[model samples]
Target: MGHGVVLAGLCAALLIIATLAMGCGAMPIRAEDVLGALLRWIGAHPAQGDDAIVLSLRLPRVLMAALAGAGLACSGAVMQGMFRNPLVEPGLIGVSAGSALGAISVIVLGGAASVGWLGSFGVTAAAFAGGLLTTALVYMLGRRRADIATLLLAGVAINAIAMAGIGVLTYMASERQLRDLSLWTLGSLGGTDWRRLLAAAPWIVLSLAWLPLHARALNALLLGEREAGLLGYRTRPLQRRLIALTALATGAAVASCGVIGFVGLLVPHAIRLAWGPDHRLLLPASALGGAILLIGADTVARTMVAPAELPIGILTALLGGPFFLWLLLRARDGGVRA
Candidate 1:
């Protein structure tokens, strides 16, 4: 299919899933009510109690999920393009692990005494800092060698260290802290509000805005660094900019939604399968695909157990883990490459 057709389909699916997500929570607003509530919010109609639920509770959560998923997936597509490796993702380079460690530290150290908005801000800030710092460190390490392999290795080491840190924090955590940490690590859109979404929006939006502008540069880099340089592309600056964007986007997402995985890896790969590896098409399509997947997953998570919502990370992992294994097997069979 053409890019336009694929993107349109993905956008339509995303809208359907998002609407379902808005309607399918514990209170269970009807589809028409959800649309009516949205219309009322825009001053097209009078308000009602259902409008309050949709406007106040569900809308922010749905928007956050879509934004988080789009940011992560676009970050992943950029990473894959920069490294020329299909397997690379935000978590592969320690962004999620570092963010998790930071969030866990806050939960463990800050305690129940730090309740409310201040506490939430503390965690989000720490997570963003951790993710950015880790990405920077990895970038620095890889810069010395100026090679993708070195960067990948640096990421592996950083990821290991970050995970160890998270484990230590987990051990030191009190029961409540541990419980909170577990939920954050597993990921959820359940606790989101307009405030948290606003906090995350600037970073996500800035990163998303910056990434697509480098599509041609990413495409050039795919031809190898020497060839890209030969073609007059500034390899170093492009790589640095892409890394920074990735850090910013992924950090914001991790801060907002916890350690949701595989949207990055899965979305880009699937988009590539359908549309080929053209970065321009791949990047936006991956974002849309990621949004669709996460919204659908979030819907299932909220409604599957009724009053008790599932952590979205578990659902994505359950789906993506098998897909990842299949990719690995396919690569081994010579059907794909790094």
Candidate 2:
């Protein structure tokens, strides 16, 4: 399919899915009602009752999911392109684990602020910081060897350390903190609101804006390091910038919504299969595809059991795990690299 057609399709799917998600949940507002509520709020009409519920509660979480999804998908796309490995993803570098550890630390030691907006912002900040720290550590370690294998090994080491830290924090947590940590680690959009959106959206947006600017660099890098150097791109500096931007995006995502997996790994691979591995189109398409997927998964997660909600991370993993195995089998059977 042409990039235009695919992008338009993704945009349409995102709209349809977002509208559908808006009408889902215990209240189950009609689609028309959801549209009307949106129009009414847009038109400066005072929202009350159902309108308030849709405008205030449903909308923010949906937007949060979209932003987080887009960030992760973009991060994954770039990671795969830079590493020249379809299996590579942002979390491979320990951003998610580091973010989780940071948030867990705050939850266990910081008291009941997780329930408040200010405290929520603190957790987001700490998570962002932790993610950056870990990514930087991995990047520096990898830079010493200056090869993809070294970088990946560095990432593995960092991932293990972050996870171990998370485990220690989890073990030390009080019951309430433990419960909170469990939910956060598992991931959800359930706690999002306007304020939380304010806290997390900018980092995702910044990453979204920043990563695509390097599309040409990524395309060059994928042509092999020697070729890219012959083309005048300083590969080491390019890698540094990519890692930094990816950490920002992935950190914000993990911080805001906890450790939602697979969107990063899954969306880019799917995009590559559907549209070919052109980073220019791959970057934006992955963003839209990611939004569609997470919104759809989140809708299923929230409405699956009505009064009770499933963690979206679980849903994505459940879906991505089987798909990953199939991918592995395909590779083993001599399938082409994306």
Candidate 3:
């Protein structure tokens, strides 16, 4: 309870700070103006002149970052527990690549975001389908008559294929499409709006709700497949459901915010260090931690370079890469199991 309170407080504090920071700088708006704009937005009073900067642009980006962070982090925690491997994540298992492929295909070939509702849905549908397809393929190929190692290897192969396809798509794309593709690959939470948030929130909430129910199943599966089967937990069914849910959450997140990485991987690792390997607590803690970290990263990305923003993905890699290596080294020295 104490730990939970601390985490909740941290999350709230970081969110408020990020929200305020987002409104300031770049456009160089005053704090009073930002406060006035917020008051107006809440039906207090209308701000005169252009309120687009705060109301239309930055607010949505911050909200999207929060949602994306939660989605990805929760997805990562689920994957790690399902696979019984801390190293596994959406990016590692090909979900992000698959989602990217689908979205990119829509932009490059389906006239995405330009052709009204048909085109908009086309991109999202393509992304979801691509993500599911990739997960299915990985599951099929990874199983050596239903073996997890085989599934993992197959996922690696599929990830490679999807990445190669991305390269080809990049080469063949038009100038504008290529630019959009490049930006998406780098990842960002800019340009979000209430409509976009509404479209994404349900999926995020649905995915998050699965964590508590699957906590015991993940714990059982961690004891090994044969043991889990003998222990009367249908391993395969749970695994399938986990993979499906992960694909849904991760695909939606990538589609909405591009391919933001590390939040999933990094948050789970940090939570484990704090609370140990109890998925029940790990899930929510990691979710909050991920939201706070990504919000901070996004804040840094937007502010560090002033008007020109750095990609959120770049910021995570710059920070997470070295940190991941250090984790690996410590894990090796301590001889920790997956």
Candidate 4:
């Protein structure tokens, strides 16, 4: 418990450091100035400095990314435990694709930029609706048949269809729309402001608070439906709750951050390996671990090229893809991977 607390503290510190460091960018602001501004804003007695960059720019993006990372990782951990499949990512059951399709629909049909918060609003709603709808469809199609395999396969089919829709939208998009879509898809912590953060903060906080409660329940469910049922845990209700929570968190993330992948898949597994597979510890640890990793990656994305920025999502894939492949190979020995 002490170790968990210590590690959580370390993760939080690293997240802050990474956020501040990444915020420095090519913005021509000193770290001290940024820190002082932040302190002053937070009601601390800061000596002096303008909070222009901290308030107007960096703070929101960093916060948004951190929230998104934590949310996605939490969702992934829950999904894996619920499904008893480590390879199961937040999108494995078509949630991500559903979100993407919703965002695209808004982009193409609603003229995303014309309305103020409409872009985010429409996209977020679409994503949530899509995720739930897809899940319901998959569940309905597979449940009566008593086939988990078919359910997953249906998710795949739905994902492919959603991707096809996205492709068509992209193909028909104007140059500006294409550019907007590309950046959104690639993912960035670059252009966030307070309003976006306000939209995202609630869901992330709610998820952070709510998701961990399922730790014991998830552990029980992992032992199979009958075992879980015999232990006074209702399997179907638990599964529904897990799916809903996972979808809500992931949908909110996709709504805010676009489709940043692998944080969810990678973070929980790393925590499980280090701290043992206890969801009680794994859930919060994965949240902090994910935030740290993302903030760190975003820092590199900003500084590695200097004066120019890379998408944070690109950096995550570069780091996570190889690790995922290695995980796959190791799992071939019939151990828990992903």
Consecutive 10-residue window with the lowest summed lDDT within model 3: 142-151
Clashes of each: 0, 0, 2, 0
The local distance difference test score of each candidate is 0.82, 0.83, 0.75, 0.74
Per-model TM values vs. the true structure: 0.90, 0.91, 0.87, 0.88
Model 2 per-residue lDDT at 52? 86
Which residue pairs come into collision in candidate 2? none
Residue 221 displacement (Å), model 4? 0.9
- What's the ranking of the predictions by TM-score, best on top? 2, 1, 4, 3
Instruction: Name the candidate that leads on TM-score.
Output: 2
For residue 162, model 3's alpha carbon misses the true position, in angstroms, by: 1.2
Q: Which stretch of 10 consecutive residues in model 2 shows the poorest summed lDDT? A: 139-148
Q: Candidate 4: misplaced stretches above 4 Å? A: 1-7, 28-31, 44-50, 135-158
List residue ranges in candidate 1 displaced over 4 A.
44-46, 110-122, 136-157, 174-176
lDDT score, candidate 1, position 102: 79
Q: Residue 85 of model 4: what lDDT?
A: 67
lDDT tens digits, residue span 196-313, model 3: 6666667777878876688877777778778888888988888888877777777777877888777888889888877778887787777777777877888888889978888999
